[model samples]
Target: MKEYKFLRILDKFEKIYTKIGVDYDKMRLILSMKLTLDSRRTSTIMQDQNKNNNEEDKNIFNRALIIYAIMGIFIGITAMVSFNNMYKFSILFGMFMFLVLTIFISDFSNVLLDIRDKNIIGTKGIDNKTINAAKITHICYYIFLTSLALSWLAIIGSFRQSPLVGIIFILELIVIDVFMIVLTALLYLLVLRVFDGEKVKDIINFAQIALVIIMTISYQFLGRMFDIVDLNIIYKSKIWNLFFPPMWFAAPIYAIEGGHINQIIIALIVLAIIVPIIAIILYIKNTSKFENSLSKLNIAKDNEKEKKRGLFYKIGRNLCFNNEEKAVYDLSTSIIKKEREFKLMTYPSLGFVVIFPLLFILIFSVDSFSEIKNISLHMSLNIYWFIFMVPTILMALQYSKDYKAAWIYQSTFVNDKRNIYKGAYKAVISNLLLPLYLLESIMFIVIFGMKVIPILIIGFIFMLIFIVIQHIISKNKLPFTLKMGEIDKGQNIISTLLGMVILGVAVGVNYFILINTYLLIIYGVILTIITFIMWKKCILDFSTN
Candidate 1:
């Protein structure tokens, strides 16, 4: 009986061991796999960290050392070359270079910070506990502070000889630095929130236009402040006193006055009041409507998509060898397949027209209205031409990309090449050109008033002509391509140069016509005829193959 019980216990123990048996080899393999994955992840993180460190070091060196060195050399060279005017040339050159460098560094650093934040936030499977927004913010704030320090250092190095002037300069630098930082932050946020997707490009362009306007208007103000002009008008009306106030504008004046605390206090008070008021107004306006503005933008995006779909359908049918229904179906499929390409074609075109005006406002301000008017009138005619022409180049790039992705398969189904050309032409005109032209018309009317109607009509006609020319130049190729991120520098240069030549002619015509109604009509008629002829020739050539 004892032997049997012992055997039974042994049997049960064997069964339990079998159920929980470990395959040593398999366990080892699993361990190895986990180790490999962990190692790879660690390696990737280390590599990314190294890359980021390197980039940060490079930017620091470039901004802090390289830029200063370049400015110093440039100033020295200019001073030497100018001989007798060495002091004057050096001062002016130093001022200009420092200003430009400050702007560039500020812009570049902001972009880099954005890219870094995006990368960090986008990292996969990172523990929420490990992420620190405050850390990132601190780092960015320090980087900006460092850049400002470098900028100031450069300024001091440039003008160290004059102690009194240096003191005034340092004070001015402090004021400007604080102002620019606040302004840049506000503007950056405003742009990102206000402009969606590719519309940011339009804002940038508008900022450029604004700069041109501001420069023209500010020239008189600057001249008066510097005492370069003895215009009694500047001293008489106290307009200069109110508008071009001494606090910031009279840096030279302050240097000459030699540390008058009372005057500085008065200026500071005026600035304090003005700055807070502006900031409050901007904050209130932006905060109040930001949400609604974003919603409207989203709606606009949906509308744009619908318009694109409608255009593709219409054009696709025109390009088809078969029945309209079949063509429409084919086109829709093609578009769906190449949605990214379509976006690429559309976004840039929209950006060109929409962003320029906003950018103009930012850079030039309202004070430069006269210069703005002159430049706008001169460039207005070519704006449409550029609007139409640029898409062709962008389309060519897109088409090349699409072709690589096998989008060319759609072409094989078409009975004639002309059908394909016709569809693409129609697609571009309806989807891109018409919307942009409408926007341009609205902008011109707003900026130039009722007098711009004739110019708008003339511009539209020229725009049509340019589109045909672009199609012909591109040899009836679909603007959709599959190549990603490949830029043809040669083609870009050629296209840009050609567009400029056309612009020159438009400007010349505007100059001759001035505000004469009959002259405007005559010019418009002539331009329309020329454009129509060009369109016919180009379209015929494009349709042939």
Candidate 2:
């Protein structure tokens, strides 16, 4: 009876849902319960950064909407920009689709992967079909709101074309939104097939990391999609390009806006309409299997997976300074990798270090590897993301849900506490970030030629120096020293913002001399010396206090 506003509106669609073979009452009941629980939850992406860690309960959902609306401003600007309407819309739709997809990947994982309904509702004899309907509905409810926040300006901007066009745009968008969610569902289904419970979770986390880099970096290549001839950006419809969904969605706008609808355009529009219907039908048929797959989440760990020693442990054993530090390194790696809460709340720039250059290559230079010589220097921008992200994510090492075990940090008899901090830092570096950074440097050298070697070298040195400095300046607690609930949200936000300013200075200094081989060598030399000095004496002074 305590229906949310949207659920109340959905009640009017009971007949339509019943026609689709959904149990209207049961689905609504499930949704009402789930939403009631989740409405208290903070948005993972926003995380209400200014909230005091110890603050009592409050709804930051409105704050989340504000964040979405700000993000929407960029999408709105993309819509209003003058270009070939088709190309413009393609960019708009591409950004929109990726935005929705990335947000879905980031925030909707819990709903999509939840197994509670299977245990609770299924035992009551409700079928998987109804349970799945509720799950899908739960995801849709929030996605719909987020999309509207993003789409509001785009939608209103369309009315300038005509009310009928505006109305038509709404209809098309509704169809396209349905398409996106199913497309996402199908992607998850594919992931579900290959990985069992924990592995699937890791893939989802990697996806969150990967898609985010892809979204920001892909914009660099958007201009390439349109051919500029005679000082005019003209988009020619290519039959081969129809494989992209944004093109399918944008074709309707192209046809309606002063263009003769040809076979290709008509086909594109038809697919835009028909494909989502087929996808929905297909998804409905798979509803049971997808629900049943939830059992895997509750299943025991994979025996072989448990047997493997991680590459990080091997590397950390040699890379760390001493035995105690090496032990701490391995311990940190285990906690960081295995803790879901850490993965969810944490922002490891190490992921960015590994993901950024690869995503940059995939986006900017995928088509013209040899020709995009200009992008080589521009690739230095990749370092900016990791630098700016380091302070926030690196801080995650200090907090864990199992904070009670942090007493072990004190129990260890050691002359200096710095070893404890140093060990964990070395683990993060050796286990993954360091090797991947070097590997990516080799890939960059191969693709962009030797011209980018100095940039890559400077980036690696800077990554080491920055992480050391940030860790030293951050709280001097032992790893996993505080409960996750006690995260210093406000302090963390301020420090992260401050890190951005410092990182900007680092980037500016790096870029100032990057083109000159002499200054580049000098800068790298000075940076390397500073790195050694910091790693030895200064980094530990404040880090262990």
Candidate 3:
């Protein structure tokens, strides 16, 4: 047999995991080999750079992976310090799981259900059980790598506290991690079986985005909760702990460390045992069905229906651009709504947009009703931070995996490059910025009352001016027309910093100088005129030729 390119990586994993289960490890090795080969092939990293030059690229990638893991260790340390030494084991264990769980849901979910793997591996004589087990264990290998980096600091702290607690902590970490990997795999299988196989790919993409949002909000919300109360209060609250997944693992830690071995501890242990067993049984039993489903997944279903036109088409069209720009508008819209790579780059900003304002409210708002009224005031000012998303969206708009396909823009006759710029500008505003602004606006209005409407309006106009100027600077590049790696990273960082500074000044002026309704209306009109002039100059100034 010809040795596969990925055989070396798989052999490394196989030597360790083989002790766990021979058949599963073998399948995992094969699946890992296939997935690694597929990824390298798609990434075209080694394709562009031959064996002679690729050594540096490989080193760069390994260095990046190590840096990411180091960042995780820092997060674990942060979580540890925040707990102030109370419920040391629970806090440490919870921090590790929290980091891993977020990474699993937000990052690894797609890897788990990569349709390429299903299509390639399923066609072989491999049984569904082996294939399914292979995917789970492959994910485990990744989590294990992450765990090694994430757990070391926490584990050292545990040992420093008590040897028994340290030992139990390691044991609980293994159980919870295995339990998490199995449970997540089962969820992927369930989603695959329930949704159309072709659609499952898209469903997983959106599911990952949704998970990022949930994780961001939960992290901020929990951080606030932890600040207000001691870690012990949270651990002891049966009601709170029931809803918390980390607490489930922490229950044993609590039991081992002098807490009563009561119904809750018993329940946690039973669940710890039962959930993985059930996941394993269900996965094994449905292995054939799962394989059959994957095979049939690509078959088109006649029952699928066309989605109706959305509000973006109706309202955003009129707000941003004219008829000549619709081609650019529609192209940009399709790319954002459909492009997975675009979403992967852009969605992190969306998470921060939503998370930051909520964090501002949490951090600044005092206990008094009057002071609470000021929360919305702070939110209205902070919401202008979303102005930065427009520039980020524009920067992201320039890159694509299929960037070569963008040659059509050059070949086809384009009357004016301005239409393309106008359309893309509106697409970012309408699709990304407008929705975010509206969400923040409504949130501020409900909390601060109707008075916030003026501040939001003023802030919106300045943001309009800000993105318009930023667009003019950046509009030379067409949407999805450049390879992601080809974009000027230094220029992007400078533009992003400038955007933050400009937005900061605008928010300060609005919050302080434009407080009155008359001043706001006058400023809004002046800024609106400036925005219009900037848009006109922006389109005319840039030329694709």
Candidate 4:
């Protein structure tokens, strides 16, 4: 039995050697082949291990997927119910869903593309080639064209039953197409080339901001014009089409029938006369100073860098002379600036706020003073809550981004460990949290007016407290450097639970204190005191770190 087992083992070894391209007679060759084969097998095993690890992580976060699925079902059911009622609510809900889905998908795709771009950097292999600038530009152009074409097609399709309507639609489409083509071309030139400096590789960043502002103003004017113009005449008149474009001609007719023809004509004449003058002035001004301005900006940046270096050196020299408190404060300020990027790219979802408010006002048409007052109160409350929540979420995201970038390198400079922690805490508050709160306050005041000033003050105080609590929880409990996609889901869960608890307590406190003008003042004062104490403690804690 022992002899048989030995023979079987030898046979297995021989088969293994032969399968791995090894010659049994040549011992050295056989050994080398075995080593190579073993290495490859080990690599394959490691890859499989990693795959299993990723799968495990996905399983751990399976709840996120379930939550999203549930949300989808709820929204779908609500939409169906609204549709059955024959209310425009269903249509609005459908549009909202479409917008949200599109935005999320597009944003996520962009994130993936960015990661791919980063991975491909400096890779020379053909298989790992990066997307070129021309390819990106082409893709953007195609997306724009396809969207425009689809919009035109949808409009035309809706008017298929009426030849006159179809004709008007076609004429309108042509005018819009011509205007957009010219506007886009001009925008591309002005923003992509004119503003792009040596340091700016992504001209799209600046172009997007300019495009938003231009589109907002343009649409406002177009809507007014459409109220005045006669679509039929505008469609039929070749001369008017050539001179004014279909959109411009149609607007006046629409406005005329809508009893705003005089206003529309006056606005159009003013725009026609002023637009060229403004364009000429801007062109001349930019052309004359563009090179000089760019040179100066570069020089200023260099000087700024030098100043930072000098300040660092000075701090280093005076390390022993200055009190720890002052040193911590200065370090924290620097860290905040570094982390926040000085609000260069930190803006709330302006598109959501703009579009939603306009739609709400238009659809509801609250003409009565009482109705308007109620809307103002309800909207004010909702807006404040949204403002508080959205910014907190965004600030969390900003923290994640900075953390992922390994910005803790700046902390390495500080000798005191307490100061390091302090710096980080201060950085988040000063840079990310403060600006958002300030913006929220501005938006609230604009929307709600001075009547709710007391409420606004109280709300602001509560928001600050919430922010501090969130920061403490995030810092101590949650891991830094979360993936961008995961942050929103994670934040939603935490914020919902915590926000409800806090709001519940706040409501109880307000009721206990009395819910009138005096209550507002009292709440505001209490909030102010709490905010001050919390802030001071935060600063002290940060400094110690």
Candidate 5:
């Protein structure tokens, strides 16, 4: 295997590392193996892993950095945009920090929380410092690569303004990265320290879910935080803005450029520096504790308590038609309920389905409380928007990291194979979409009134028929049988757009139908029949692969 350039650079610091009581050589070896193994796995955010195992595709991580560099061009533009300093940098750093934090949470969490290293290597007489150093370096290497890709343009832009400005940006950038990493580690460490057994493990898992939810909601507020008119930006700070970290990081630049300082700016500067320093010290002290906390991941859960999942089985029994369908329904719902990675991947889209359109309505669709009652037609059309999630969610359902376990599906006897997807489709709808559509329906009914209920039922039934046709007709992969490495983000975007287009046609057809209540009732009946026929056949009767 080719040596990593970063490893060669580290060789020069070997004496320093060794003197600091780390086994530098062993640490390097461990990190090298990690990189090599990771090279075979595709990144979730940046690129598709070439399933062909092409030689050229081995540099997937390098190509991912290139994508980040391309994204950095926007940061450069934001830094140099013609606007007030605080407003622009708050926006810039908001984008910067969001990228760093989200990427760290999704991609690096697996690396950080993985217990195989501790289990396998800790038994071989590797010192604590060496193992910990190796783990920390694995994380830092990715963060450094990310920052290098994402900050180069911003650094250049700041340098053009003033060398000191550029230097300060670099220093604060490092500090912010350190603060985020340390703070996250500290949260997990404290939870593990305080709680015992399955509770801490379950709490840590939900913490990731909570972070995703909070991050997505905050993302919506970013656009709302500024007022833009005729290409000019205006931002007025409120006391509430103190809740956002981007504002704190951006204040120093504003103060520096304005040639004045205030108590608020001084406080922010102290926070920007002091908090990270404190966090680093505490994190360093808890290094052993951090290692122990990661070991909790290896704890085996009591499967006996899974009777609580009887609710999931009841959902399958209620939704499917036959035993074959019921078995697969139980299997699909179980995975959806238990898999952390599935929730992480799908929750953002799940949130977007609600947030994007509701925010649109709040900001653009209605001007006053009275105007909401007049939006019946708007609500009717927007009901179809939930179909936008079908392509993405169904695609997510097809791919899994544990695709090999799917062999169980093939090894089992099935008289009717089509019932397998039937069950799987019903499970996804019942478990994921049914609740989302119903929740959105309630909100829409509250806003547009009970008059929207018929439309929601028609729209939802139509979605079930439409999704089965799209999935079974387009690319029918057995549930959870495809490696996630085969996915391309571009493919997801295109599929989602196609879903919108298909549903848009129905919305147009329903527009004239809405002109007559009788025609709308007839339209819904036809859709119900189509859904029944689809349940009868899933594109020539498919089987789990």
Candidate 6:
């Protein structure tokens, strides 16, 4: 086994795990070896063939860490709301665990399981118990590191109060982390044991999408919860403690601090100790079954290729386009739908567009519907919606993980490249823009009532104009034909910001100047003419590199 930094630290606890039917040293060695190999594999891809790529990877990681830190700060600041250390610790730890759990679900397969590891290490005489244990250890180390970073200030403050409180805080976090890891592992193993490997793999993919949705939703809701429910509410209604796992740890701390500890807290504390043990037992018993299915995960099902032609294809073919345009539209939609990397990159942004606008409305509103019904409010939100939508979808259309495969576009003997753009435009409109527009329109109607129809119509027209302008500026690449790493991030950000500003001004004008229906019609017609000219320019004169 390689001399892993983690394993070297674990060496001090040799006698502990050895007592529980675990070959502590041997398991550490195997785990260290497997994780080392996996790290090398990831590092190789991240660093790639040059120094610049390595720097870019570092920057991306740093940016990711910064985002995580920002999330932590939000929770930390929320935790500071009450002077009660118990409430502060509970809220911060709970939110941190939630974020960590989200990350675990999103990246667990790649980070811990590494389906490839099953094949690589299967030949080595390692038992399922050892591999599974190593996986738990590997996941724990990283999540703990992240938790430490997230809770540094809170933990330090706890230590200021008393060394025991701080030590308990750290120990409680370890227990919670262990419970979460075991719970997730048990869930994965159970799914594998019950369902086929391919099904489990599909579930994992879908779960990633769900994780993003959940992340945004949880952030918004959890922040709201902290704002609404303070220590008084929590103390009065102990039922809240029963639902939140972090409260289990917090209750014990409260008890230690000479605070009131009730039956609910006592039960939670007991469950906190028992649940992880049960999870570990369940995982160990199912490891062989899990491993068997995992090894066969990559084997393609014969039925996958036989998927029937769906409504998307029918819609694509019948879209009001000439043959060339229809072909581009179909191809573009196909890539967006079928390409995993494209879905990963694009769907999250689409989900964000779906989520963020509503969240912003809720955040700003006194009575949600009453505030939303205000013309200026809805117009501003619509401006933000269209602004974010155009850039995100356009940028998503430009990138593909397998960009080299795009050579087919260059090889084809086509004189008019604009037809390809037209087709791609239709794809963007029908597949991406239309659904989003309908969703926004429906939401507007619901929130503001039937009287909002004219505003929605006006908003849709402006969105169309924005989309056309974006296409003229952005649709130079063949759809899904550029590598993600090669994308101009600054260009996209600038375009998005500029779109927001222009549309924001338009929103203000339409609200203040074109308040009545008659003035709105006049403005809409003028905008329509401008949009038509831009559309013509986009399809006829614009060329992509």
- Highest lDDT against the true fold, candidate: 5
Cα lDDT for residue 379, model 6? 38
lDDT values for all models: 0.44, 0.72, 0.63, 0.39, 0.73, 0.63
Per-prediction TM-score to the true structure, in the order listed: 0.48, 0.86, 0.80, 0.46, 0.84, 0.76
Off by over 4 Å in 2: 49-58, 81-83, 207-221, 229-231, 300-312, 344-370, 373-386, 399-415, 476-478, 481-490, 512-525, 540-545
Give a tens-digit lDDT track for model 6, residues 1-545. Answer: 34667777888877766665566766887767756554433221121222344232233333445556665666556544545545666666667667677666544545554665556655687666566666777777767766766766667666776788779887877777777777766666655666664456655455555655664554444333333354353443255556566656766667777766667768767766777678777766676666676765565454433332544445645764577777677677666556655654556566667667676666666443355556444433453564457777776676776878777777886667777766776677766666776787788677767766777677777777877767655534666676654655566667777777877787777777544778878887898888777766755534344
The superposed Cα distance between candidate 5 and the true structure at residue 64, in angstroms, equals: 2.1
RMSD, every candidate, angstroms: 16.6, 3.8, 4.9, 16.7, 4.0, 5.0
Q: For candidate 4, which ten residues in a row score worst on lDDT? A: 41-50
Query: Per-residue lDDT for 1-545 in model 1, tens only?
Result: 11223233334444432343322233233233333333332121011222333231123233343554554555444323311122232243234423433443333322322333224432553222112222222223333443444445444543554565556545544444444434444554476566775454345334433433343334334433322245321222223343432233332533354434355435544663477457634633443233223232222232344444575456644544445334434553445334543443344335545545444543444444455654545444444444535534434433433446444445456554444444455455555556656776787677677777887777666666666655555443333443433444466566666766765676667767866889989877887888757644545423222
lDDT of 5: 0.73
Badly placed stretches (over 4 Å) of model 4 are 1-190, 197-379, 390-448, 474-492, 504-515, 537-545
Candidate 6 colliding pairs, count: 1
Off by over 4 Å in 1: 1-157, 160-228, 231-452, 470-485, 510-533, 536-545
Least lDDT summed over 10 consecutive residues: which range in candidate 6?
A: 42-51
Rank the models by TM-score, top first.
2, 5, 3, 6, 1, 4
What is candidate 4's lDDT per residue for 260-338, written digit by digit as tens? 3454445543444444445534533343132223232121122324434544434432433335434544554453333
User: What tens-digit string does per-residue lDDT give for candidate 2 at 238-334?
Assistant: 6755666777778888888876577878888888888899999988888888888767666546443452276656666676767777778768877
| Model 3 alpha-carbon drift over 4 Å, by segment | 1-29, 35-60, 76-98, 171-203, 220-235, 259-308, 319-324, 348-352, 366-376, 472-476, 484-488, 539-545
Among all candidates shown, the one with the greatest TM-score? 2
Assess candidate 3 and give its TM-score to the true structure: 0.80
